[model samples]
Target: MKQTGIPLAAPSNPNHSRSLSVGQSIRHSFARYRGVVVALSLGTLLSGCGVINNMMYKTTGDVMQGFSREHTIPYLMESGDLAMGCAMSEATAPLLMSFGRVTDEPDQLAVMLYLSAGGCAEDQGREHELAALAAMYERKGNAAEDAMIRQKRAYALASKRYLKSWQHHNTYYGESGTGECPDFDDDLDEFIYLAGLLSGLQALNAEIQSTSSIGVPKNVGSIVARASSCLENDKWWGAPMALKATVWAMIPGAQPEGEDAFDRLAMTDRLGEEAGVRLSHVFHAIAATNKGDEAMVKSVVRRHAESLKEQPANAEWAFVDAMATNIIVSISDRLWVENTGHRTPLGQLGSFWDDQQKEVETMDLDGLL
Candidate 1:
């Protein structure tokens, strides 16, 4: 009844004859007017809205009937695909936790994440309860402990699923041939890993909030740092991906993969400030560990106050940016176990794209805009 991990595209899009090569996909993404390449195809805007209910779910018929194999498969294969995949994956986590079913494909993830966000945002009593039940599987401890445990389970499961999606879409070397990357970095795979780190950090943050689990939150930050380190000192694309990576790595004790990734992915442009925000998580972690300068811990909160917008013309760019937004917001929201703000934690739960409950929705971009 469910799929697994992130699957950027379908297995095929039969329209292979008309499909753009990997290189073309990247170019098409950047040219706004080109609007030529984006998968949104038709008036994709709200086509799938029905499937989501109040969440704007789309119906199956809209996606599948007209979708070409070419569009689906290549989308699945591309780097940005993971962004959607992770979103979908996390969006749907609550259902997976409740149903005890998980999917292997990332597209399915879209539905999960969307749902998780919606549920968490609105505080649907039943969905939240079901999510708590799902948390029981991986977390340990008592009732209060259990509630927290459930929270961590949600974050970790979400984090793990998202990690797989980013790893799947990116190559350690990046897609230079396709101009899909910002620059060269061996340790960092373009800015995509940034998405992984963002999702992971959010997971860790949420997990920490739900539970007093000591190790997980720290580890989440560590992963963020590691992902950042992956691109450190490298010519990061200055896109959302790199910025996200920087923020995660900057988290005081997040994932300490090493200084290498950091050096490789450092900012060469204005991206430094955004990257700095990610590091706030690291600093917060450091404060928690007593290894950091607590004074610096305030940076994250301050950074969020700083408005930063990186326009993403295509799926990959937008996906990464959205992932980063959630991660950062979650960090600020979950900065303390006190969850003192009473802000609802972002559900690091499931995918937003799990239409297995329905059918694929499609819009013929050729006719839409």
Candidate 2:
């Protein structure tokens, strides 16, 4: 056999050595990614052998859609462009759904599409929320009369998108433990099921924040409380605890006897810190912000900032890593935009509050941010 491709060579400049190293690194990553793609394609072909495959195209469609959702989505989100990300999701979701046309378990594909669609909507909703907050700041600075109107419109759109996210989640994971949804196995399947619950709750929170028109229903609280029990200690770190704490904090008189919302939040915060995934901190900060508890918000933000400084997010789960950054950065962005007319300070994204101790002054614009 003869080698045909270009031969590898060292760079002349030692400084340019990093370029070769980076290219090699990319090659290794692509090798692994290609293996996954090859495996899926092989599996798809192996399953499409005869009448059996014809009868079970549902399984085939599921495998293909899963690949699309898993591979395409994270890249779109990691691009750091929300409008483009949402647009990509909108375009890809229907392609995944089209796979369901030949499947018996059509709703299975719908569940996945709805979940992905909900996430897409959430990205748009957060963009709207940030814009609304910016508009509110403009009004505070004595802007034109239309500033208030723009703020209101932005909030309305944010609320509408969040409502859509919640509705999509509800369609699949209907009121936990109700036996109304599809069956799921343990391990990753269970984790995904729980994630749906978390997604629905998150959307509801956003909706309430933007419009104040929605209330935490008692039934939903009960469902989340019940669902939290299924999450084991090792599987989700503090996610289940975070969910419980969020429910307790949001619903009026929902906390159990001898337990407080802050206490639960603190415990979840510790767990998230240990796990090196600080989603609980985001939940805590948001809940505290809603309560107008500035101290608690700062506490959560500072702790999360410190943790992120200690260790950057793991790249193995880059979607979650990006999400953690997005949430924490949003907190910093809120503070900076309100105080200095900017987003997170340069190079101080995760450690903004802790390192700089930048105090966000209180403004008189209804505390919207």
Candidate 3:
């Protein structure tokens, strides 16, 4: 009943995606992540290709065992970094929800990276290496000294504090200007932009506390201020996508309330070009408001809706869906030339996401997003 928690998304028919046997998907996933697969290849050959997620990473590894391909993925020697990167990748995956197998793990590996890296069986999202370091110092170091005990206690406290802060860290970033915004910067987590936001916040808090006498509070005031200015001025970098919806509403002769949130952003030309498809959503939004133009509205909405339907199921993201939905409502989406806005959503106005347009168009963005 619930697909990825987005009520609006049309559930994807398996037909939209190429259905492969477990072996096939595994082979494809393994091929792309060959470095990880090579470690497990021996097992694949020995076990007749049954090994997948279970063997690749297990609860505990045989540290003494030498390259047990049948039981383990050959150590990437790089999984440490891979783990961290994957964590970030997954966190950001929500933005580009359906890209590929990369995000398909549902950020599981990413979360595992945090758990593994944090070295927690319970998954508090701490960096495991940091935990191991404290353990090493606490038990191996001179336990005979009082300072040593105090030192260990301090480390324990620091770790706890870092963990607590992360639990409360903000992950909700506003993406739509149609609703209320909290002083414009309340949602920006620059430290953890995309996936690593909380971890980033946790890391920063830990680093500062580890290095300083008193823990410095997370100060995002300046960053948040700058982010708001960027939005007001249409600076897309480090900017929240929520403002994008407002921008879409601003096309002339479009929705009347759309202009309510319009702030003249600088570099309008570039931003317009970058968000052409998203901007197309503004036209779609306006089309929804046009009463007499039912035929044109339906045509525009259907065309954009079709594009949404055709959006890559693997790559269809939240913004992509929202933009597609927004675009269908835009009046310009239905117009050819004379009635369109000065800046068309992206280049032409139909569909966008350059990486998309090709492999994605056929996937049914509507069903996928």
Candidate 4:
């Protein structure tokens, strides 16, 4: 049964309660949860009007739908705690999937569930990539002769997880070169779909970086170009621009006529900062790493570090923001392990060996003892 007397969109006045008001709301709650309402009413009354209003709002379907936009999706995007977010998403997968059972393919709930599942897979892929980095470090050390083998295994796993992420995207939105637009509920859903496309490309990039045996796909450049064309630069906090700039920087001659890769990358950096996402910096840093341009890498890293210091709080699109930081940190961590036989310095995550003042440093000796 659909609940009425609730506004589908936000009420024009913040203080305006719906037509149901408190008495009707109480009756509706009583009807839905009779005994349960009686037990909860005492505590709710003690908590004041705010709590009671919240309880009433939640009883309505419209409010519940709004809850997904304001709370559920934002939490998915902006959460700082990666482990907890992954666990929660995994736990809710069944419920999210259940929504799809009753809803059509183009339904909002279906899109949300698929986007969230894609995120879960992306997180798992990052974990596998981290494992690969650890194994790469082991290969650099003297004691681990099997590290190369382990690194290869981890990279393979990461690639698979990324593929899983994209598969979620393909389930509803279809794949690239399909010659169609996904029938999304709105702009937000379309943004999420495009983000999934980027996630898949990121997985391919990771695999290519990890091993020379697996070559980059010839069609990858066209895929990036097509993905970049779907959305305006402003959508989803300039994510599309970031994707476009990253491709230009990474793929030689990919930049459009009269436009340089450096200029496009610079524009992405500005857009990311304006949007408070800073994901473009992450992409730029990775591209620099791929090119072995140590100077460019250091420049990107320093700017990223400064940006983080300025806006440490990720109040919006938290997941994307954190993922960007995670990638940049991994890049620095690898550089540190390769040079100093240790991870990046405590709290100095993005700084690398090039920042060191001297080539030689003091070492502990048995003679000193």
Error of 3 at 246 (Å): 3.7
Write down the lDDT of every candidate, Cα atoms only. 0.39, 0.62, 0.35, 0.64
How far residue 127's Cα lies from its native spot in candidate 3, in Å, is 41
The true-versus-predicted C-alpha distance at residue 230 of model 4, in Å, is 1.7
Residue-wise C-alpha lDDT for candidate 2, range 81-125, written one tens digit per residue? 544544654676576566657653333334434444555655555
Query: Looking at candidate 3, what is the lDDT of residue 310?
Result: 49
Question: Estimated TM-score per prediction?
Answer: 0.35, 0.65, 0.21, 0.64
Ranking by lDDT: 4, 2, 1, 3
Number of clashing residue pairs, candidate 3? 37
**Model 4 residue 367 lDDT?**
71
- Candidate 3 overall Cα lDDT vs. reference? 0.35
Off by over 4 Å in 2: 1-63, 66-88, 105-116, 135-184, 210-218, 350-369
| Candidates arranged by TM-score, highest first | 2, 4, 1, 3
Per-residue lDDT of 339 in model 1: 24
TM-score of 3: 0.21
Q: How displaced is residue 152 in candidate 4, in Å?
A: 3.1
Model 2, residue 161: distance off in Å is: 6.5
- What range of 10 consecutive residues in model 2 has the weakest lDDT sum? 104-113
Candidate 4 ranges beyond 4 A from true positions: 1-71, 90-145, 177-184, 209-221, 312-314, 358-369
